[model samples]
Target chain A: MIQDIMTVAETAKLIEAGNVLLLAGDEAVLRQLPKGNWIGGTIPYFISHAEGGLATRDRIFVTDVTGVAQSVEIVERDANGLAKVYAEGPQEGFSVVIIPALSKAHLSFALNAPNYKDFGVRPLIGWISGVHLDDLGKVTPKVFNGVTGNALEEGAVVLQATLKPGKVAEVGIVNLFEQGGGDILTFPADGFSAKEVLVNGEKRNFAAYIVKNKLDTRLPLVADYYGALVNISFQGIDEVEGEVKFYAPVFTGIRYKHAKPVADYGEAFKACLENKCQLSEDRVVFSCNCILNYLYSGLEGKKTDPFVGPITFGEIAYQLLNQTLVYLEVHDV
Target chain B: MDVPSMSRPQWTDLVTGKKTYQLKFLAAKILLGRLVHSVKENPTPANIKSCIEQVYNVYAKNAGSPSVQEDLTTIFG
Candidate 1:
């Protein structure tokens, strides 16, 4: 896998060379690339091979898929058009999608992806595009369609890549946090923000409940989706409004518990990878970790070896996830 | 376990937590989660069948695999 940070000139060369690529960089840098077979999302933060976690706008992180992909098709879809995302993807291949942060497409995908037609039938993996933390409200995040050289802020740009014969793509996640032995939390409806929640079967103000328990907001609410431990990270709480906002929507009928505290995020993440993930480093085509992990764990210059890519706003395995590391690997059968 | 011999009520029991069966596969778990939520609201035959068809759609690519076939039989039969 050709995954690394390169200068804009070098990235443009790869694009011109017709290599199927998934590029991540500053919006300005990505806008400088030539048109070709690729899709790009704006983000300055990344966990690079040379430097573990660093933010740079001058270079782009490129994942060259020319070797693994037999053919690649780029599609741009709005919130409603995203309904066809999985249904339209190559039957035998995987998709890489990039939706701008805070866009309608992002909200729609996070809240309704589970109900999408053929949802989870095929491997769909990607990240939510975001600007520099400093530029959060100043500049909107954008995704680029290399085919048309168009950047979009309201929809998603997807790369539907058909893999080589006998090769299969698999998406997996590494979540360091587990459900703690805390009160069972349930919400009344599916949404990203909530004012009320059921705590151990009792109705309570969601924000007040968190404040009363002195919960560490950095840790996400973990739920067991079958064997998969899904995470919904905390975005913020409005004390005046008595509302708690989450990076991903919390669904009704799902039981959630505050995640157990981690003594050291860097060490725990590395250990989880070594123990839980049996990955062939070379076979890993792409991987990305949540930006929340980067901020909370102070990942600057710290390496989560064997897995590295963009430090994104949110991650997507089959659906939107938060405070987790998601990766895609190809295996020959 | 002769899962195919189980009745709709038994399957509902498993999903609704009246019974238990360890599901294998993320897709199965996800589909079952949706089914459980839907059945709780309205367990009409049409709704149950629709949810069952979704589970089958996800496993359509693996329809030939013995484990997938068994799971389909266990959940839908």
Candidate 2:
């Protein structure tokens, strides 16, 4: 539940003692730390006590989990085998993960991790670490496992915390967008690629469908997955292939029944931060917001109140998400 | 497509629809990402100074966060 920034030297002390910690900081700072009982990723942007957003290269955002981590596991650089970490996660409590941004393992875990949900695995909460100013799309994101001191550029590192016997951890997602009135669109096949999708059952090229309807590309495609709002944010519409791609893969079987229109991001986000939160700000143990929301909502210099953490490239709450906020709350049950 | 080549203000100019649509989309997208963090735990001058510099660096590189830019001006100016 610890959320605060510390100097690289101070952070090194936490890592040196083999204390469970989750970290976000500059590459140089993260690289210098003495690896111990911790897992971390690279990111300069964060939601600190300061208004809006702040970036730091000198300090590291440390989430002290020294007493909380009952056990930890590191998932090696296996694309398809990434989900195995969750299978090996703490069964009695919850697990958190840190995956390198834009890695094959990140996409692989996103596509397959949801399967573990049905098996009744412990809640999975974490984010994809990335670099700032990634406009040219040249990103080199990394994840760290202090236990092994592995500063991995691929695969992932997971920390499965078996809360104190009387303690419980619950995962929550806060999304403001709902299905808007539009042609029901869904891809014919799964994976990140979609050439033609059923637009009310009539096949149409995904890009052409978007262009034809003049859809607000900023708004994500939302599907109600058993009452949970699953969002598939658009990456771009390739004119050459006439295909539509999403930040996270949208499985074909999900049958995206609705298009969630984009709302006034500032107001919607403010409200979600204030009212939609199931757990009070004081009770929030760990939370992360999608980078899409951070960029789309103009979050710089704005306060999201109690909901704060690293603004991540992607969010994982059992499944990958876009333009949404995911949080972990521990309750003494 | 030539985002890095364009100046921050030029890229942000698209947000008003006065510039290219692609740049506008990119600008709006980048500007919207807010990094909300609480520094009450360690509000030391050094921390705040580094945070300001970081905010400036992010904005200077991307030129999307005008609010942060204004904050930087207020702090340093």
Candidate 3:
């Protein structure tokens, strides 16, 4: 059922079967697929069901839906589609979203994501599609709604699947990184950029503090906000400005209760999978991991037990996440 | 089939063939560092076995390195 680099002829068969699919492949290959009930994005990296990973431009990653989708729609800022989903999303199955990477919509969604959290939207699970490593700069990332063939980069293709009667879908994340209790680092102001921060009450340049202390950028900064563990992942360090950029903006208003460093990435990752995957294998329907984890933990070929899918630029469970595995599991209610 | 023991250039040649596999090799080195560190710390019979399996999993799974794959099967089995 799991295949890499599928031929157009083979893909045509899946389309004919009327199955709902989530696809990952090159733009040309994806373009060749017959329009049908599917949503896809561009990416060559995949965590397949075959106990390892694969990166291929010739093939596509396809996962067929177990149940027929009740409804499907493409949401775009131009169409006010996200608002519609927020108001009318199904109460049963989760909404599957595939967003193109680094597009205007992607940035808009990431920044305004907290607003969606407040609106009580349906369970959302998805990833940002990306260009192949070789095509990173040459081509823009694209998402596809098989019903529409190709979609604008700045839009999200969503499928609202209605789980079979009596079936229920649950979304969750498996994060291996826990606070290693290092220094207490906090930004003085709310927003994504923290040029200077309070390192245990001492003002210091964020980038300088990281390099001087040799802090592990891979682990991310963990904040305990009202008992909920929210991880603010490191995006990059601006050397000239001495500013630290984050995947998700850190709010100054919310006190960072503590700062956690990843103890040991490889061991922590392995242990987390070992502990969580024992029961999730049979229930998990679809899953995707953050590319940060893929690069930092060296997971190119490593098996993450029951979790597998695309290694995306970013992962969305309800909101954007970094260095974590997000999955949707279904069971009969 | 002696992948772990092979010299860097030899291994790269075997894995990459005539083409350059620079990006793939760069990714491998990062994982290899962790594997080496883990093996050094434990070195237990069980630990060594698991670490070797993981190293192969992370570095050589889709590496197109037939000898390395063969070696992995032989060593683990």
The digit string of per-residue lDDT tens for model 3 on A1-333 reads 333336567777888887778787888788888888888888888877574666777777777664535555544342235544433556655687777877766776665654442232355688888877778779989888788676667778777786666665556677776666678776778666789888888889989988988877776787643223556788789888898888766765343423355455557767777774444466777888887777777777787756778888888776666677887766654
Top model by lDDT, which number?
A: 1
Any idea what lDDT model 2 has? 0.66
Residue-level lDDT tens digits of model 1 in A1-333: 689999999999998888999999999999999999999999999998789899999999999999999999999999999988878888778899999999999999999999888887777899999999999799999999999999999999999999988877777788899999999999999999999999999999999998988999999999887657899999899989999999999999888999999889988987887787777898899999999999999998999888889999999988899999998888775
Off by over 4 Å in 3: A1-7, A68-85, A117-121, A225-228, A254-267, A276-278, B1-77
lDDT against the true structure, each candidate: 0.86, 0.66, 0.64
Candidate 3 chain B least-lDDT 10 residues: B18-27
lDDT string, candidate 1, B1-77, tens digits? 22243244655465554555565445566667666777678777777666656665666753433345556655555
Give the least accurate 10-residue stretch of model 3 chain A, judged by summed lDDT: A113-122
True contacts kept of 3: 0.00
Over B1-77, each residue of candidate 2 has an lDDT whose tens digit, in order, gives 11232234532332222332221111112222211121233455464444334333333432322232333343233
Q: Ten consecutive residues with minimal summed lDDT in candidate 2 chain A?
A: A114-123
* Local accuracy of candidate 2 as per-residue lDDT tens digits, A153-227: 888877777766665556678887788877777666667768889888888888887887788877888876534
User: RMSD, model 1, all Cα superposed?
Assistant: 3.2
